[model samples]
Target: MNLSSKSVLVTGGAGFIGSSLVRELLREDAEVTVLDNFSAGDPSHLAGLDGSLEVVEGDIRDSSLTSLLERKEVDCVFNLAAEPYIPYCYDRPAQFFEVNANGTLNLLLACKEAGVERILHYSSSEVYGSAKHVPMDEEHPTLPLSTYAVSKLAADRLCFTMYHEQEVPVIILRQFNCYGPRETYPYIIPELISQLSKGPDLQLGNIKARRDFTYVEDAVRGAIELMKCDRAVGEVVNLGSGIDYSVEELSHIIGELMGYDRVNIEIAKERLRPLDVERLQCDYSKARELCGYRPKTSIAEGIERTIDWFRENNERWIWEVKIAPSERIWRKDDGC
Candidate 1:
């Protein structure tokens, strides 16, 4: 599991967290290969690491991925490829199943065929929707409230099954809300920042819902540490900052940070989920004990970093704005 001399494949390496992970791996001198279809991902996000990493522009569900893995002599596989947006999953459940669930199946098969030594499957805290208890841990009963959550949960279990039956060295990390630069999705913090910058009026849905927001860098660091921990095999670890904040509170904070005295808030019915999970706060004791993983960034610090990045890369941020509105609002009649 030592990555120093290993060859790694990071699926969906062009996306938000995956791109960050790719950069870290390259810095550590690992021979990296990235497989991304550019569906919800953009290759431009990975421009800095282009020369150091091999890029394969193809879908994870394609049989070609197996061949590519075998030819590349991949030592380890990190399955970060997924349809991450909840509302998009509601609008396109079949696509969600095809990409998140079946795409995971394809990657597992490819890993097996390539004799990849280890695999780290990225999962989400949404799998433990509406936390049945405070500080939700790996042992919490999973009750996914969205199709996206359900698909990710299914993939997480698939990794567990692969480890038990197929003997693949696979581990799962149920990541909480990870946010940072190059993340174009209209998640709470980014959405609030974008809206506030546009004007004083910010429209959203379910402001009272809370989430455990982990910095993207922290989540990526935790994932890398877990990949080197042999004891993590066949285990599910939660990656989070062990903090929670309501969307309402987060928006207000962003408004203040942006120098706005006050901001107008509006509730748009179309922005609400059909079955929204009210709250999520993680229990990161296992991650800390196992891999010495602790979030190094506070919420305020992380928000400031994200805001700074957005401001510096305003053009890229603005281009992404066009894709955001459609990406955020869920529609039942959209042929999911």
Candidate 2:
């Protein structure tokens, strides 16, 4: 579908990645409508973006999404809204199923009813769990360990099921860890920047765990590129840097960039997830072949950019948010 002049609905458009996608789509001249509950997404992320855009405060689980699609004459839908915090899923497992699984079902049904031409559903790399092999591909065995991963896997499979059984024009875009400015959660990147900015001493957990971190802008570019590729429909494609880095390695690099003098690091039990995936590396060969997807940002450059953003935007929550690494069971706190 040619995105230019097309009507697009981006659920969770106020989110980190979603907002970035909105910006790119607007540059493509697509009329965009954003649906979000504002639970984790902040309206300020969408600020200063010029486009034919509308923001709606709503949930993906709502049945009324069909009417909204029809009313807006939306040509395509991008589903990014979900309960994405891994630790939060531990306490509210059912909420993950409700939002990530059933909520996706709602959106698919609405697309069918509204005759939306295509829908791109965002799936997480966590669904793949630890890599049984290096550079996990789309066919990687399903071995989700956490409640969050399980819920995402459920929704991931749901998108495939709808595509095959109901003929829903859907595509599953499974992206790996994305980090950049305007991030809502205190993910490793933000947390590291947050902690490193304060002092040289660092407290972290699962430092040996490895992940493929894709910069937010690169991820957004890949999503838009896939949306324009008709062949990507009914397919699941991976978007990532195709390079993995351990948390410990990441910390040292950030420390060097921050110019820390003999940095001190310690393992903090509170920061550990009970069933954390030890490693994840993406195999985006399918995406590369189908849509010419290539992640342009290197980890060092991405981190540098992120650090610069935080440096300039110190008033952001990440700078002031209290990180209780010493507390037992350090709950995911925004420190708002």
Best by lDDT: 2
All candidates: CA RMSD (Å) = 4.6, 3.8
Give the lDDT of residue 332 in candidate 2: 34
**TM-score for each model:** 0.93, 0.94
Q: What is the per-residue lDDT of model 2 for residues 1-336, given as tens digits with 9 covering 90 to 100? A: 689989999998988899999999999999999999877677888988897999999999997888999999999999999987787777778878999999999999999999999999999999898999988999998899999889888998889999999999999999999998877436888888778877888999999999999999999999999988999999989999999999999999889888875668899899888899999999999999999999998888988988888777664443221344212221333221
Collision pairs in model 2:
none
Residue runs of model 2 more than 4 Å from their true location after superposition: 318-336
For each candidate, how many residue pairs have backbone atoms clashing (under 3 Å)? 0, 0
Deviation of model 1 at 45, angstroms: 0.8
Candidate 1: tens digits of C-alpha lDDT, residues 65-115: 778888888988888898877876766788788888999988898888888
In Å, residue 100's CA in model 1 sits off its true spot by: 1.1
lDDT, model 2, position 111:
93
Number of the predicted model whose TM-score against the real structure is largest: 2
Q: Candidate 1: deviation at residue 54, Å?
A: 1.0
